[model samples]
Every structure is written in structure tokens, then in C-alpha cells.
Target: MINYISDHLKNNPLLVLDGAMATELEKHDIDTDSELWSAIALINNPEAIKEVHESYFKAGAKVATTNTYQANVEKFQQFGLNEAEAKKLIIKAVQLAQAAKAEFKADDLLVAGSIGPYGAYLADGSEYRGDYDLTITEFMDFHRQRMQLLNQANVDLFAFETQPNFEETKALAKLLKTEFPQKTAWMSFSIKDSQTLCDGTPLNEAVKYFNDDQQIAAIGVNCTKLENIEDTIVNIKKVTNKPIVVYPNNGDIYDPKTKTWQANPKTSSFKELVPKWIDAGASLIGGCCRTTPADIKEIAEFT
Candidate 1:
């Protein structure tokens, strides 16, 4: 699978797939907030999780991330659990992916452990960056446990996505380089503008931070509009030659009628912008919120 992802990156430049979506699963009648949603949900019903994986696999995904992004210690603490519970959750999510890979004979499906930010995202730009008891040391300790579980799961890669803050993202990178030295790690910084991460660091500066790390396989953007991805990749290209990946949100993120978070409409239609992303040097591509298997199918067939 590693070779497959590596080879695809060599040829296509944009190996696209669907982005990680929790609420979308909930809309499909799965529990988006299940205790297992972070980990156990996949373990409890590998078949159910397999269904999602197969959907994307058939949709032409080169990578399938285990639904472990929210399975972090801090998030489990919100559910009144401790670090041990969080570790178990992460293990379960990994196990479920392992099962699905074998069942579908998806030898080429790269299983990436989805690692989201430790803080909440506010639409108005007010994230939970508290000046309180939990110092960066404490927070990095929490991330270390998650990384351990992902390493133990033997995932092909670690994907730190939706990381709004540069401080937190840098902290995770430091931990991976020191603790999980054997595993490949990638990063996707969410954007507030075409050129800057949500915390306002320019993409070029962010690229400089990860450029020297050999463990980083690919680095790019996720959870932004497709229309903005070409510009982001082009900007990132100015800094490093690392393989670039993008998982853009399906257009129309905010919907008043349904109050949907990632409204799954085919905003900008896949055919139009996918080639643009490829031409701009994107090495990996996929959908985020509101993206479905069909959208992935469109990308695979068209791209």
C-alpha cells in the first residue's frame, strides 16, 4: 500500500479520495457522536465501518483513514473518560480498518490515522486556546498517547488535519519525530484564507517548519473549499517539493435550511477543478465534509 500511494503520487500528482466526515455518517443513520465513533464504533461493527471504507475504495480512494481523529484523549475526557479509554478507542478504530482492508482485499488502500486538532473550531475565529491549567506540556502528553496507538496500529501514515493553530501543529510534529520515528506523518492545515492557516500563519512559513523532516511524506491543505485548493497548493509549491495532498470540503459548507455543517452538494463540480488541482501540483486529493462516495467516483472517473 505504501508503494501504491508512493507510485500514485509519482504519476497523478493528485491521488484524491473522500475526506473524513463524522456528521455525514450521522446523516446516513450512523451515530456521529457514538462513544465508539472515535474508536469503538468501528470495532463494534467492522462491517459497518467496512461499508464506508469500501464505498470510498470503490470510489477510487488511494487512502482510507481510520475514523480516529476525534478519538483523542482530550475529546474522550469531554465524555468523562481517561487516557486509557482514549487509547482503547484508538486501537479499536485501527483494528476496524485492518479488518476492512483484508476483507475487501484492498491491498493498495493506504490506512491513515486521522488526527484532528485538540481544540474546538469556532466559526467566528474563537477557538479554545485557553490560558489555563493544561500547559503545552500537558497537551503534548495527550497527543503522545494517540500517536503511540496509531504506531501500534501500524497505520501507513499519520494525518494531522484541521489543525488551526501553528503552536499545536508544531507540537504534534515534534512529538512524531521524537516518539514515533518509524512512522510516516503528514499534515493538512485548515485555512482561513487562501494563503494562511486558520491561526494566520502563512503556508510558506508552515512549509518551512516541516521541510527538513524526513518522516513527513506529504503536506498540504484540507477542509477548505475546492475553489481555493489550487491556490493553496500553488502557494505551498513555492516552499517545498514534498508531495502535496488536498481534501477539500464540498462546496456550500453552510446551509440555512438544513443547518448542515458540510452540505454535500457538488459545489464547483468535480470535473471542473480537479484537473486544476492536478495541474497545480496536488499529489493527493479527496473530499472532506459533505463529500460522498459518488463524489469520489466522479473524481476517479474524471481525473
Candidate 2:
């Protein structure tokens, strides 16, 4: 299988991923406060999703991540989409992103299909806690249908991101190897700190688990605090030689109960930290929650 990220990485040392999708969607006044999250826009307002992709491209992003992060077959069916309808919606996400890239005329740009953890479907923030338990087969069962859809939809690669469970991460990598041999993905975990995954798995241990997987093009963390990213990169490099992918949140504290964000005074400016992250060996850099295209522009400029 051709590693799509390498095509972009060949010319540049780092692949600049786009900023948040749900974050950008919220700015469009789209109500993302639902179980479906950004997938709701795929059902009601797909054009807005496309425009967000274009905005990131305009902001100097080299990749557009499809708005399928929180989308899944069961959730879509629960929200009134038939299985076929849900599948179509997933395919539509890839189309919308591909359309944006084509319109941007950078043919060099790429589209990564977003695959969030099962915890995202639970909608209780377990993705950041990794407390949920599922056997590897169960994890594969829940994720296989969607991965099959994204594979057939022709995504350049899958973005298995914000993964918290080490077992679940194993499931994704195994599924990619046995089922989708033609595809490759980047696996990113949610962390409790620089050295540990949200589930308390040591970052180095989880990272070393798949250090030999050729299908996993990159490995690192996402949706983590800015304060942890620099150290997180150092930790990941200690385990593997794969490309390191890091995209941290804006560092604002989120009160999930109230669905609000409070400023974190100690958080340094995103621009101020870009060089440090790059120097720490982050080959794939971008923004996560609360980050904007402007932040992505900072990374693009610095790289």
C-alpha cells in the first residue's frame, strides 16, 4: 500500500493538518452539542462542512480531515438514518472534503477520513478517560463497518485519532493489517499527561506495541494540553521511528457539564510554541479543539 502521507511529506518535513472540524462548525453557528457532534452537519448542512475544509486549505493546511469523527453506523441509525443512509453519509464526508481539495486546485493536498473511538458514540467523554472496556473483537466489530465504508469511499488514509484505549488501538491496527491491507493510518492517543495515555497506559509502552507496524504511518497524541505536547513528542520519539503526529487543544479548560470553555491563563500563545514542537520532531502538526485555521497558518509558516 502506498503511504499517502509520505507523498506530502516528501517535499516538506512536516504535514500540516487542518484545525478542528467541530470547532470550526460551531463557529458557523451549527449546533454540535449532540451525540452525533459534527456528523449532524453532514446530515443537515454538508456545504458548510466543505467550506470549512476550504478555509483550512486557504489557511495553509495541506490536509483536510473529513467530518466523520463522531459518526458511526449505530448512532446514525439512532438519529433516523437507515444503515444504507448512514453509509452514504459517511461516504459523503469524504466527497465533501475531496471536493474542497479539488476546488483548491492543489492536487497535492490530501484528505484523511476521521475515525473517533467508540467512546465518542457514548458521548460521555470516555475518549479522554479510557475507562470503557471492550475486547479486541468487540472493538473491531464496532469499527469495521465504518472502516470498510471509508476504505470504499477512497480516503487517502484513515485518521484513528483521540484513541484512549490501548486495546482499542490494537484493534484498529489489526483491522488495518488483516482487513484493509491496501490502506494505512496514523494512530493518535488521548493522554492524561506527557508520559501516560488517558487510560494510564504508559505512552512508551503503547507506542512500542506497534513500533513495527508498517501500516501505521505515524503515531503520537491529540486533544492534549499544549503544555504536554513538547514533552509528549520527546516520549514518543523514545519508542519508535515513525513520523510523529501531534495536535493539541487550545489549552482552554473545558467544563463539559456546562458545555463551556474557560481561559487558561498559564497557557502560552500557540504561535510561541510552534517552533518548539517542530524542533521536538513533530512531523505532522495541527490544532485540535478550540483551534482555528489561523493557528494552522502559524504552523504552516513556521514549517
Candidate 3:
């Protein structure tokens, strides 16, 4: 019921979001190479997940995105977990973040329940491609269960992140607007470039689609290239007065064939980029893949 993000923004210049979950988990020695990605840690290394959350909080992040990006009942069942067991793991991801908040004793901390796109469950890099097709009902059916679970878990808010498919984004907005009216979310896309979503929807059109929806707390981009953010933020700000939330990858190039992220020395650090994003009107900022708590600390310092 509390708008943790907007409330923070009212008193503070910007809200600081936590960095990567799966990659951050690796630093604690948790294997995240599985199809489940960071969600695997919920079942295998929950303690480490909690530690990562605490690390982000200690590093100055006011928001912790739960380790549920790839966690869904169907995906967990593939590992032989029953429906109830799978659901428990989903909730456990939330509990670990809450436990971390409690351990840190931060009254202002917020836990955002992460809901990745359907492609995330495919684990086929389809999320970046946005080439999947599903009817509205089918899309809602696939996402509803997890949203319901997260809602029941009482997360501070939902983070509909890295969403690519426009139809899927429409479906999620409809689901939230119709069913979870009391809940608030920030919908961030996986953009293809400065002017288009991964699915090829024009950035202005897609951003304008949800511009009037109060249930959507903010709208912008995430899990994208850092170089892609400033222009993308400028584009979104043009169509919507809603706050813009952006957390880009570490400016490393990802290779689909090798599924590895390569560091590019040409990439500018967050210190150089954060000021531009802030100037461009980004209200909440953080890091995505390959970015660590230090990046978040840099963002916090500059903000």
C-alpha cells in the first residue's frame, strides 16, 4: 500500500536501486549458470542471496530487487519441485530480501518483487530478441501466478523489468490495472536502441501507452546497454511526466553465441554516466548485469 519509490522521491533527489542479483551472487560463490539464473540461489544458496541483499543496502541502495527474475512455478517444477514447493521458493526469495532489510535495520528500505519476461523462463536469450508470440490470455496466464505469489508476499512493489514484448507489456499493465489495482509497479523495457523496444515498438508509442496509468509508478528502460540509457531516458521523458527508472548493464557487450559478457574499455564509468542520466531526468538509477555494489555506491554518491 505504501509507495516506497515515489515517497522516497518526494523527499530525496533520487532513489538508489540495487545492482545485479545473479552476478552479485557469484561474488559470494553461488553458481548462477543454471537456466533458473539467480532464482536458483533461492533453493541452493538462500543465505548468500540474503548476504548480497545486505551488501547492496550497506553500499547505499534504498531498494532491493528480489531474486525472482527467473523464478516461476513452471520453471521450478522442471527441477522436480511440486507446485507448493515451487511456490515456497518464490516466496523465499522475498523473505531473504526482507530478512536482509531487517538485519540492516533500515526503515526506508524497499523490496521490489522481480517479474521477468516470459523469455526469461525460456532461458534462450529470447528476452533480448522479443520474438515470442502469445495471446493476451496466454501471456496473462503465464505471468499471473507469479504476480499473485508476489502480491501475497506483500512486497513493497512489483518490478516489471526487462520486458520486451509489447503484447506482454500490455497484458501486464492490464493485469495490474484490473486485478491488482492497489499495487504499484515500475515497467522498464529491454530496448533495442534509443528509439525502439526490443520488440520493435517505437519508444515514444510504448512509453505513451502507459503514460496516464497511475498504477505504473514509473516507466523507462533496464537490463540494457549503458550507452543506450541517456538517449532512451530522453526519449521516455518526452512522452511521459512519470518518473523514469533506468538501470543499465555494465556497458559490457554480450555475445549470444558464447553467452558471455565482455568488458569494453571504451565504456564510460557510472560516475561519468550517472550525472548525464540525472540531468536527463532519470528519477531512479542503478546497475544491471556485470555491475556490482560499487557501481551502485558510485550512483549513490553522485546523487
Candidate 4:
């Protein structure tokens, strides 16, 4: 199936929908500092992760991301695991997602192994700084271990998502081409206000950097407000004709006062937003933080 998807992408690229973050999955446990962290809370509770997958499957998601975005060395270090232990945890995360995918007989569903940035922020705390703290070689070495596990799991694709800086993205592109070249890699940037990536680099420059790497199957934005998605995609199209993907965070900026995401996502209802994304040339659409199966269902209905 992975081979089939790879061929399909090589020929006729199609709209790819990513799975929503499992915020609800975090409800199963309250261990904020565990190696598993809030994201991997679903690992111990298999049924919870399975349920989330099933919801997205039913909602019409063609691609489901494994719940492993934060299972990397840096994130685990927040909980005290060394690099080796963190790598193993990443492998375990892939296994758990595979099991969930199997239970649903989601043979046709694409399971993208979620690979996020190496560190929470690019070295300079601005756009990805490849040279800020380490060279491209160092970034390659760091990702090599996890990419190996994702490849072995036979996941449908590799998503190098939520990057804020360009330098880190450059390193990621180089690493993907050299290591997991067989897997289709989708890169999405997280943006701030009218300016650039989360790290302040212009989005256009970021796109151009990724464009040089043929390993990137698709590119676009995620983890931002819906209001910003339209402009983000429009700017992206100017740089490249490759397929675009957008999965905005639900409209509400979290209100720490209430500890909840703002209830009304202003961009549009989930149903309305799908068409907007498609109209804006988004070949892929899904939800990011604060989104749920309901939102995905709306997207699936359109695609």
C-alpha cells in the first residue's frame, strides 16, 4: 500500500488530509513530565488512540499521522530520557499506531509517521538555524535514527511538520533525501503574524529552500490561526506549483484564563473551511491543535 501511494504521488498528486492532534488522548493520563509526555498519553491506553484513528478514518481522512510527534530525544529529555531511550520510545510509538491502523483494517488509509522538528525551537529561536548550534551533519545524524524506525514500520509517508525556522528545514531536506528518500515527505511550516515562519524567516524563502529538495512531496502550513491560512497558501503558491496542504489550529487562541482553546474558530465552520482551503489551492486539509474528529469529518465530506 505504501508503494502504491508512493507511485500515486509520483504520478498524480492528490489532496492529503492529516490526522488531528490527539488532545483528547491526553485526557487518559496526567503525567505532564513523563517521557511519553502529554502527546503519548494514548500509548498506554490503546483504545483511546484507536478510537481517534477510527474517527478520522470515518471522517474521510486518507492519511492518518502516527501519534509520535513529540516522542523524540529533545522532548523526552524534558522527562529525563537520553537519546537512545528516546529513539526506542519513538519506535514504540510507531508500533502502537500500526496496531491501531490494523484493528480498523485501514489498508487503504495512509499512515504518515509524524516527525517534528528536532528541538522545540530552531537554534537561534528564530527561523530554523542550522548553524546556530550544530551543522547540517549533526541534524542528519539526529534524524537518521528516527527515520530508520519510520521506514521500517512501512508507514505510508513521512511528514516533516511544524517547522518554524528555515535552516532547520534545510537540514531536514538534506537528511530526507539522503536517508528516507523512499518515503514521501510532506513539510509544513508554523507561522506567526503577517511576517514569517515562527522564527521570523519569510515563508517564501522557506518554500524556495524546500523546493530544491525533490524529496518533499507536498508543502504548506499548519498550527496557526484560520484567519492566516488563506494568505499563507496564496504566498506559498507564488513560490512553487507543488501540491499545498493546510491544517490550521482551531480559531481560538488558548485563553490561559480559562485553560481552554477559544470555542469559536473564526475562519469558518469545519465544513466551510474545507472548501476555502480547496479554493485557495490547498490540495491537503486537516486540523491541528484544538481540532477533533468532527472537524476532520467535515473535511472528508468535501474531499
Estimate candidate 2's alpha-carbon lDDT, on a 0 to 1 scale: 0.91
Per-prediction tally of clashes: 8, 0, 0, 5
Better lDDT candidate (1, 4): 1
- Per-residue lDDT tens digits for candidate 1, residues 1-303, read 243456666656467655455644654466554433424354344456666776777777777888876567656666677767766767777776767667667545678888776653112222222112345565578578777888888888888887767777778888877777777777888777678877777878988899887777788887777788988889999999888888887786654244346545556876678888888888678888767887788778754
**Candidate 3: tens digits of C-alpha lDDT, residues 238-271:** 8899999999999889986577878899989999
lDDT of 2 by residue, 1-303 (tens): 989887768888988999989888888899998999889999989999999999999998988888988998889999998999999999999999999999977777899989999888899988889999999999999999988998888999999999999999999999999999989899999999999998899999999998999999999999988999999999899889899999999889987567678988888876899888888888999989988898999888976
The list of candidate 1 runs beyond 4 A from truth reads 1-8, 11-13, 33-46, 77-86, 120-136, 255-259, 262-266
Location of the lowest summed lDDT over 10 successive residues in candidate 4: 122-131
TM-score of each: 0.84, 0.97, 0.98, 0.83
Residue pairs in candidate 2 whose N, alpha carbon or C atoms collide under 3 angstroms: none
lDDT of 4: 0.68
Q: lDDT (0-100) at residue 291 of candidate 3?
A: 88
Candidate 4 ranges with C-alpha deviation above 4 Å: 1-16, 27-36, 73-86, 121-133, 255-260, 265-267
Which 10 successive residues of model 1 have the least lDDT summed?
122-131
Error of 4 at 255 (Å): 6.4
CA shift at 173, candidate 1, in angstroms?
1.2
